[model samples]
Target chain A: MADIKSPVPGTFYTQATPDAPVYKAQGDTVTVGDVIGLVEVMKTFIEIKSDMAGTFAGYAVENEAAVSAGQTLAQLDG
Target chain B: MAERSAIKRLFIANRGEIAVRIIRAAQGLGIHTIQAYSEADAEMLAVRMADEAICVGPAQAAKSYLNIEALVQAARDRDADAVHPGYGFLAENAGFVRAIEAAGMRFVGPSADTIDRMGDKVSAREAAQAAGVPVVPGSKGRIETLEMALAAADEIGYPVMIKASAGGGGKGIRVAKNADDLAQMAPQAQAEAKAAFGDGGLYLERAIQSPRHIEVQILGDGTDAVHCFERECSMQRRRQKVWEEAGAVCLDEGIRDKLCASAVALAKAANYVGAGTLEYLYDSAANEFFFIEMNTRIQVEHPVTEMITGLDLVQEMIRVSGGEKLRFTQDQIVRDGHAIEVRINAEDPILQFMPFPGQVGSMRLPEGDGIRFDHFLYEGYQIPPFYDSLLGKLVVHADTRAEAIVKLAKALDELSIDGLKTTAPLHRALAADISVLTDSFHTQWLEPWLEAGNLTATP
Candidate 1:
């Protein structure tokens, strides 16, 4: 299991928008180039993507939770 | 003049050293200090030092610092009698100032109308010209067409700077050396201006080669203004000043007098109140200085002026905002010694000055004579990845410019912030550089020196 980390400190969102479904959920398959989440800071939102293909295990941070750089976002099962 | 009211409780809408500075100033005046912070600034020094603290919004600036509604609401809820925007954020936002005033709290800066007048580069120029200040050779207003831009460029002479009337912060500016250059650069500058400022207005000014960046600090109480001399802030990168020193030693006494007078004239013309800085480009070859722009709020390097004038500017701003007259006249204001300030930012100079965010593992600050360290960082404080990377400001003073530089260098050597990459090493190099030591460099000098790896290689 490898943990995916946030690249920036901001509020993390599991979905693109509040009305949209979660980009990725537990046990869902994600691959490279997949935007699993978004981090909003300083009025800018950045997409959090997965680099390694795997089954999404679970999120370390809840939706809309504050996160810091290098903090775990989600776990990936190879 | 407005009716007078005491600032019994003051709220500072900023973070970092500036926030700390304003809080300290308010405390000195026996006014209770309230600090508004984002969630990320929970452990900040300003938060700890203020009389009261509130988290107005999340870590994102738009929801907190720059949000006029949130800031005004926080001030009102805290029962803050006044609000001091300690630079950046919404400091120069006239709309924010209006909102604060609308909430029945005095905004500790210029009036909303004054800010609106000076915020626009085009009208600011017109106001300065109306005051008989020497302005740069440029177009009267925003030039919309390439043909007009080219014609203005030719009239202003070669090597013209095409700038966005609505743009600032080192963006939407281009230097064209010839008509061909103008043709190629004007459209690009316009496009950038449109994208960045939501305004496509363009203007032309004759570019002064390797000019020194000098600025005059002025204090006003609605009708009258006085200058507190000038600061040589030519040590800049991307138009963001790093190290600043009070008194441009290169200027003769006569030139200095006129420069300062021009600043006062302009400030008075605009009916500016509180602390404002009028920036200028000093051309040594022509021995003339031309108005560049005006910063309508207390600037980041204001400590340099404070050190030299023995004037607590933040306190003055608060006093003036509360409808009090200036405590002292121009003749009574004494200029003492020399002062230098170096901004310590959490950035990796080796990595193209990228912001380095992390916990401050341990820290040791310089102490004693003529040294002032303004910051909110404590040991183990996690530097937020959001917001600006400025960690603190180190200011030092001495009887002479040479002594001030030496003192600043020694102070930098004693300063330490472990577990974070800082610009301390770069500033130390600048202090030791012969050109900087002799005060021979200009605004365009620092970038190429960094590009050459002088911070690590030569020094």
Candidate 2:
């Protein structure tokens, strides 16, 4: 299965907010439109979505970890 | 950013020739230098010359130079006392400047407030107007609707220029000679401006015909300022300046005095610091000058001014940021000799200036008493497509304009970078042209000249 990648260079976060539940955990199922993480750059936040409909392998980066463009934020397996 | 006066080690947040320029300037002042490099630039001259070099990120500018948080962290990790953004990337970014300051590191350029004011074209026009600097007639506020632009056109008159409020380097600019042209070009200009500069707000300005793009160089210490003559940057292609010369010709002495004085006045009004440039459109027919914008940091053509003034602007910027006042007063500064700068890019002028980025098989630069070549390319070096196509800059100074042109021709002949096409031939050809020599060239000169086989003239 393909992976969800960061569309831009920025800090990555698994959840939308501090109090919100994580979007995905290990072995969780995901769809094409599922928001796996958020990539923030220059104060603009963009949602990183999975392309493959499969089981989520959790985030490669932790909260506030810097990520580059095209960096794989999460892996998926059918 | 860190407080002033504590700077011992400066982390240069850029790459290529500008990065090397900053590092050398810092080393000359006995300040320890740190260079931030992308993976592609790990072996560049700037990285090798610095006291220490660290890989900030990969090749793409967004991953490297434009990564503000990464740059700040790199500075913090290295314990860098200050950060010097040498044009491009985050040089004029007010938010980046603020972030650098907030990280307890100094940004060795203009204050964040000044950057915020001048970074935007609309506000810069207001600042210039408030300082009594002549400004092109334009809308004082953002035009939210096409009707608003139409109203502004009626008041400012037709043949107006539609520009993005946050534009630079000729992007987001559309000249509508009539109402029909305005109706078609306005929205396209706005969309491009929004994509390029992140500001879609449109404004209108009276488009001055045959205007010479002249700019005054100024150095300020937040309290005092001085002018360093002017640069004629009319030789441009697609709004990107290709060739520049010091001390514009045909500019009356009275108009020169007024332009220089107005530039200083604008700087003082902003409490501007470090090296800055005030651009203007000199309408020779009307004998009037209109302020365009103020570049908040060192300019690409800064070497031409440096060649004529014998001033190390980069060093002066660092010193001034460290609390050093203006070293030379108005009278103390003297203009000497003539200088010209040509941007050598890896592109084909015969084709539509498309970037020819690739490996540099062999490279040899000119060396002489008054020839200065600023570049990062070398034998085996790869010119990446991820950044600007500026391969190098060739600058020469001589006793007079004619002599400087001759020296430039020689310097261009002596310089060679193999396996990659460069604009050297274009500079050589342009230098030999009598029109360019006689200072009759305009902003629209290059493309037509190239199209007409004029730039292919043998040197």
* Best-matching candidate per lDDT: 1
**lDDT by residue for model 2 (A1-78), tens:** 667787656568789987999999999989888888876543346688777799987677787776766788888888
Error of 2 at B458 (Å): 5.0
Cα displacement (angstroms), candidate 2, residue B411, comes to: 1.3
Winning model by TM-score: 1
Cα deviation of B366, candidate 1, in Å: 1.2
lDDT tens digits, residues B1-459, model 2? 333355789999988889988988888888999999987678787888899999999765778899998999999999998999998899999989899889988889899999999989879988888999988877868986778888889888778999887775566578898888888888888788778877788889888887889999999999998998899999988788999999886687899899999999999999988999999998877788899899999999999999988899999999888877888998887888889999998786655554566678877789898899988877887665556778789999998999999999998888888887788888888888889888887777777888887755453
Off by over 4 Å in 1: A1-3, A7-65, A72-78, B1-5, B140-158, B161-204
Q: For each candidate, what is the lDDT? A: 0.88, 0.85
Model 1 preserves the real interface contacts to a fraction of: 0.25
lDDT of 1 by residue, B88-161 (tens): 88988999988988888898999899998898987898898899988889887789999999888878787898
What's the i-RMS of each model? Answer: 3.6, 9.2
Give the root-mean-square deviation of each candidate in angstroms.
4.9, 8.6
